[model samples]
Target: MWKSHPKALPYLFLSEMWERFGYYLMIGIFTLYLKDVEAGFAMTEKEASDLYGTFIALVFLTPFIGGLIADRYFGYKKSIVIGGLMMGAGYMLMGIHDKTMLYLAMTLVILGNGFFKPNISTLLGNFYNDDQYKDKKDEGYNIFYMGINVGAFICNFFGAALQILLGWQYAFMAAGIGMFIGVVVFLMGTKHYGDKTEKKGVQEGDMPFYKIVLFILLPSVIFGVIGWLIKGIQSDTNLDSYIFGSDSTDAFIFACIPVIFFYGSLYFKAKSEDKRPIGALLAIFAVVILFWAVFKLNGSALNTWADRYTDREITGTTQTVFNSLKLAKEIEYKKDSTELYDAGFRLQKENGAVKKVVDYPIYFRNVKEDKKPEEGSKISIWATNLSQSINPGWVIILTPLVVAFFTFLRSRKKEPSTPTKIAFGLLISALSVLVMVAAVQIGNNGTEKVSVWWLVANYGVITIGELFLSPMGLSVVSKLSPKNITSLMMGGWFLSTSIGNKMSGVLASLWDTYDNKANFFWVNFALLMFATLLMFALLKQLNKVMKEKGIN
Candidate 1:
C-alpha cells in the first residue's frame, strides 16, 4: 500500500493505528469500569452514559481549537507530540481510581485529542495534495481509515484481558502504555513530515486569532453558563425541562450554538468563489450529524447491548479457542446471590416494591435452555469487552472491498460524487439499525440470549456505511475548505461528530425505557432515514458544487 503513496502515508497510518489502539482500548470498557458496582465506580447508567457522551463529545470538539493553533503557531509535529504525551499521562492517571482524578484525566485526554486528531488528519491530507498523489487522496484516506479500525479491532481483547486479570485500573494503564507506544512510532517518522508541514500564509477573509477567541470562544462559555442556569425551568424534572436530555447535554448543545454560528458566518463572509463550496460542505455536515448520531452508538448503546442482551457465552469448541487465547472472561455464579446487571438493564421500582426481585442476572435472559444453570446453581461466562471488536473487525475485512468497488466505478467514469457517496452511506447505515430491530424480535425482547451473529451482522453492514461516509467527510473538508480556513472547517466536521456523540449518549441512557427493545432500534432507524432524506433532497445542489470544484 505504501509503494506508490507519499512517504508520510505509512508513518501517519501506523501512528493513527497505535493511537486508536489506545483510544478504543480505553473506551471499550470505559462505562463498564465506571459502573462496576463492586470493582468499578457505582454510577447509574444514565450518569455514566451522560458523562461518556460528554467526554467523547469534548474529545472531538477540542480538535477544532487544536487545529487552529497548529495552523497558526504550534505546527503539526509539535502539536502532535505534546498532545500524545498529555494523553498518555491522562490515561496513566486514570488508573488512580478517584472520581476527581478521573475527571481531570478525561480533561487531559479531551484536550490532547483536540491537538492531535485534526493535525494528524490534516498532515495526511497534506501529503496527498501533491501533484504526484492528488488523485489518490480518497484511496489514501480509505487506507488510513482501515488502519484506525485495525487498532479498534484488536484493542478490546487487551482491555478484556487486563480488566479480567488485574482490574479496571491496570486496564486503563495499558491504554496509557499503548498511547506512549503510538508516540514513539510517530516520532520514528519525523523525516517524512518535512515536505508537508509548509503552512499556508494568511489569506483574505480570515479572522484574526484574537477576534475568534473574543467572538466565538468567549460567547460559547457565556452561553453554556446561561443554559446551565436556566436548565430545569423548561422541563418538569429539575433538568429535563431545560433541554431534550440532561443538563450537561442541554448546556453542550446550547454552547455549540456559537460555534455553529461561527461556521455559518464563514460561508456568509467567504469570497464569492468559495461561497458555494462552503455552503455545500455545511449542508453535508448538518445531514451527516444524523449518521454519526447512530453510528456512534457503537460506544454507548451497542456497547450496552453487548453487555446485556447479547449472548457472550463461549462453550464447546469456541470456548476452547477463546480460553486458549486468554481472551474469555469467566463469570462465576453463586446460589441465592444477586446477579450482575450492567447499566443497560438496571431498573427502579416505585410503590414501596423491591426494584429487583429475581436473583437472576440480566445476561441469563438469553442463555440457551439446555445450557443455563438450574435454580441455585452457578455458571461461568466469557468477557464483555471483546464484543466491542465486532465492528472494527468488519472494517478491517471490508475496507479493501469497498475501495475496490469504488475503483471499479472510477474506471467506468461513473464514480459517485463525494456527497452522493455520503447519501448512500446514510441510507445503508439506516439498514444496519433495522438489523438490530430484527435481532430484538428474534431474541424475544431479551427473554433469551440472542445469537452473537446478530451483533456481527449489524456491525458488518454499518462498517460499509462508515467507510463511505467518515473518511470522505474529512477528505471533503480538505478539498473544499479555503486554505486559510481549512483547519476551522475541519473543526466543523468534528463539531457535528461531537453533537452526534452526545446524542448517542442520550439514546444509550434510555436503554431501559423501551420495554420492547426494538423500539430503541426503530428510533435509530428513524433518525438515519430522516438524515438520508435530507441528503437526497440537497443532492443536486451538492453535486453541482462538487462539479464546480472539479472533485468528481
Candidate 2:
C-alpha cells in the first residue's frame, strides 16, 4: 500500500486504527455499563439511551469549530496531538466510577474527537491533491476506513475480556491506554507529513475567530439554554413534554440552528466557481443524515437488540473457545430468586425507600423452557458487547472486495459517480432494516430469543452500504471543497453525522414504545427510503456539479 501512496499513509492508517480502537472500545460497553444494576448507574433504558445519544452527538458536533480553528490558527498536527491527549486523559478518568467524573471524561472525549477527527481526515485528503494521487483519493479513504474498522473490529474482544476478567473500570482503562498509544504512533509519523500539516490561515471574507465565537457559538449556547428551559406540550409518560424527545435532544437541535445557518451562508457567499460545489456538498450532507441516523444505531438500539433479543448462548466447542479466551462468563440458574428485571431492575418501595433485589439474569427470560439449564447449573454466554464487532468485522472482510468491484467498473469507464454510489448506498441500507424487521418477527416479538445470525446477517448487508456511502462521502468532500475550507467542509460532513447520531439516540430511546419491534425498524426503513428518493431526485444536479468541477 505504501509503495504507490504517500509514505505517510501507513502511519496515518495505524494511528487511526488505534484511535478507533479506543473509541469503539469505550462505546461498546458504555450503555451496558450505564444500565448494570449492580455495578453501574442503574439508569433505565430511556435514560441511558438518551445520554448515549447526546454524548455521541456532541462528539461529532465539535468538529465544526475544531476544523475552523485548525484551518485558521492551530495546524492539524498540533490540534491532533492536543485532542489525543485530552481523549486519553478522559478515558482514564472514566475508571474513577463517579458520575461527576464520568461526565467530565465524556466532555473531554467529545471535545478531543472534534479536534482529532476532521483534521486527520483533512490532512489525509491534502496528500491526495497531487495529480499522481488525485484519482486514488477514494481508494485511500477506503483503505483508511478499513483501518478504522480494524480497530473497531478488534477492540470489542479486548473490551469483553477486560470487563469480564477485571471490571468495567479495567476495560475503560484499556481504552485510555490504547489512545495514548495512538498519540505516540501519530507523533512518530510527524516527519512524514512535511508541510501538509500547516494551517491555511484566515483568508479574505473568512469569518474572524472572535467574530465566529460572538455570532455562532454564543448564540448556539443561548438557544440551547432556551430549548432546555422551555418545555413543550404535556402528555402521559412524558411524551412530547420537551421538544423533540428530551431536554438534551431539544437543546442539541436548537444549538445546531446557528451552525446550520453558518454552513448555508458558505454556499450563498461563495465565489461563483465555488458555489456549485459547496451547494452540492451541502445537499449530499443533508440527504446522508438519514444514513447516519440509522447506521449509528450500532452503539445504542442495536446493542440493546444484541443484549435482549439475540440468542448468545454457547456450548461445547464454542463455549470452550470463548471461556478460554475470557470472552464469555458463566451465569448460574437460580429459579427461586426474588430478583426480577424487565428492561431494568425491578424496584420495590419499603418504608419510603426503594430496594433492588437480586434474581436470575435477564438473559434467560426469553429462553425456551426446554433450553433452560437445571437449577444451580451454569450456562456460558458471550458478552453482549462482542456483537458490536459484527459490522466492523464485515467491513474488514468486505472493504477490499468492494474496492476491487468499483475498480473493475472504473476499468470499464462505467463506475458510478460518488453521489450515485451514495444514493444506492441509502437504498441498500434501507433493505438492511427489513432484515431486522424479519428478526423481530422470527423472534416472536421478543417472546423468544432469535439466532445471533440475524444480527450477523443484518450487519453484513449494512456494511456493504457503508462501504459505498461512507468513504465515498469523504472522498467527495475532498474533491469538491474549495481549497481554503477543506477542513471546514469535512467538518460539515461530520455535522450531518452529528445530527443523525442524535436522531438515532432519539429513536433508540423510544425502543420500549413499540409494542411490535418490527414497527420500529420499519420507521428506520422509511427514513432511509425517503432519503434515497431525495438523493435520486437531485442526482442530475449533483452529477452536473461534479462534472463541472472536473471530478468523477
Candidate 3:
C-alpha cells in the first residue's frame, strides 16, 4: 500500500495505530471500570454513560480550535507531540482512583485529543495533495483508518488481560505506555512531515481568534455553569427536567450553540464561489451525525449490553483456550443471593435519592434451566468489555476487501461520490440496528443470556456501514475545503462527531426507560433512516458541487 504513497505513510500509520491502541484500550473498559463497585467509582449507569458521552464529545469538539491554532501558530508536529504527552499523562493519572483526579485526567485527554486528532489527519491529507498522489486520497485515508482499527482490534485483549491480572490501574497504565510509544515514533519520523506542516496564515474573511474566545468560549463556560446549577429546578426527579438528558448533557449541548452558529456563519457569509461547496459539506455533516451517534454507543449502551445481557459463558474448547490464555474473568455465583446484582446496573429513585436495590441482570431472567449455575456454584465467564473488540476485529478483517471493492468501482466509473457513499452508509447502518432488534427478541428482551454471536453479528453489519462512511467523511472534508481552512473544516467534521457522541450518551442514559428493549434499537434505526432520507434529498446538489471542484 505504501508503494505509491509517501514514504512517511508506514511510520505515520504505525504511530497512529499505537495511539489508537492506547486510547481504545482505555475506552473499551472505561464504563465497566467506572461502574465497578469494588475497584471503581461505583457510579450508576446513567451517571457513567452521561459522563462517558460528555468526555468523548469534548474530546472531538476541541479539535476545531486545536486545528485552527495549529494552522496559524504551532506546526502539526509540535502540536501532535504536545497532545500525545498530555494524553499519556491523563491516562496514567486516571489510575489514581480519585474522583477529582478522574475529572482532571479526562480534561487532559480531551484537550490532548483536540490537538492530536485533527492535525495528524490533516498531515496525512497534506501528503496526498501532490498531483502524483491526489487521486489516491481516499485510499490513503482508508489505509490510515485501518491502522486505527488494527490498534483498536488488538487493544481490548491487552486491556482485558491487565484488568484481570493486575487491576484497572495497570490496564490504564498500559494505555499511557502505548501513547508514549506513539509519540516516540512520531519524533523518529519528523523529517517526513516537512511540507505537510505549512502554516496557513489568516485568510481575508477569517474571524479573529480573540473574538472567538470572547464571544464563543466564554459564553460556553457561562452556559455550562448555569446548566449544572439548575438541574433539579423544574422536575422532582434530578434527571427529567434537565435541558438535554443530564447535567453534563445540557452543558455540552448549550456550550455548542455558539460554535455551531460559527460554522453556519462561514457558509452564510462565504463568497459566491465558495458557497456551494461549504453548503454541501454542512448538509453531509448533518446526516453523518446519526452515524456517529450510533457508532459511539460502543462505549456506552452497547457496553452495557455486553456486560449485562450477552452470554459470556465459554465451554469445551473455547472455555479451555480462553482460560489457558488468561483472558476470562471468573465470577462466583451464590444463587438466591445478589452479589452480581450489586456489581451490575441499577436505576435511580424518581427523586434522585439513592436506591439500595441492585438492578437485575437483564440476562439472568432467561438462562436455560440447564445452563443456570447451581445455587452455590461459581461460574467463570469472559469479561464483558472484551466484547468491545468485535467491531475493530471486523475492520481489521474487512478493510482490504472494502478497499478492493471501491478500487474496482473506481475503475468501472461506478464508484459513488463521497456524499452518496455516506447516504448509503446511513441506510445500511439502519439495517445494522435491526440486527439488534432481532437479538432483543431472540433473547426475550434480556430475559436470558443471548449468544455472543448476536453481538458479533451486529458489529459485523455496522462495520460495513462504517467502512462506507467514516473514512469518507475525512476524505470529503479534505477534498472540498478551502485550502487555508482545510483543518478547520476537518474540525467541523469532528464537531458533528462530537454532537453525535453526546447524543449517544443521551440515548444510552435512557436504557432503563425502554422496558421493551427492542424499542431502543428501533429508535436508533429510525434516526439513521431519517438521516438517509435527508442525504438522498440533497445528493444531486452535492454531486454537482463535487464535479465543479473536480474532486470526484
Residue 286, candidate 3: alpha-carbon lDDT: 85
Pick by TM-score: which candidate is best? 2
* Residue 357, model 1: Cα distance from true site in angstroms: 13
- Candidate 3 structure quality by residue, lDDT tens digits, 206-282: 66778878877898788777777665456655536776667788788777777788789889978899888898898
User: For each candidate, what is the lDDT?
Assistant: 0.83, 0.90, 0.84
lDDT of 3 at 389: 88
Q: Candidate 3: how many backbone clashes?
A: 1
lDDT of 2 at 449: 96
- What's the true lDDT of residue 485 in model 1? 76
Alpha-carbon shift of residue 453 in model 3 (angstroms): 1.2
Q: Write one digit per residue (lDDT tens) for candidate 1, span 55-110.
A: 99899889988888887788888889889989988999887878899999999999
Tell me the tens digit of each residue's lDDT in model 2 across 1-552: 678888889888998999999999999999999988777888777888999999999998898888888878999999999998999999998878799999999999999998898888889989999899998877788788888999999999999999999999999999999998998999899889999999988888565789878877899999999988889988896776987888998899999998899889999989999999999999999999999999999999999999988898899999999999999999887663444555444455568776765433788888888888998899999999999999999988998899899889999999999999999999999999999999999989998999999999999999899988987888799799998777578778988999999988988999989999999999999999999999999999999999998888
Best by lDDT: 2
Query: Candidate 2: lDDT over CA atoms?
Result: 0.90
Instruction: Return the TM-score for candidate 3, rounded to 2 decimals.
Output: 0.92
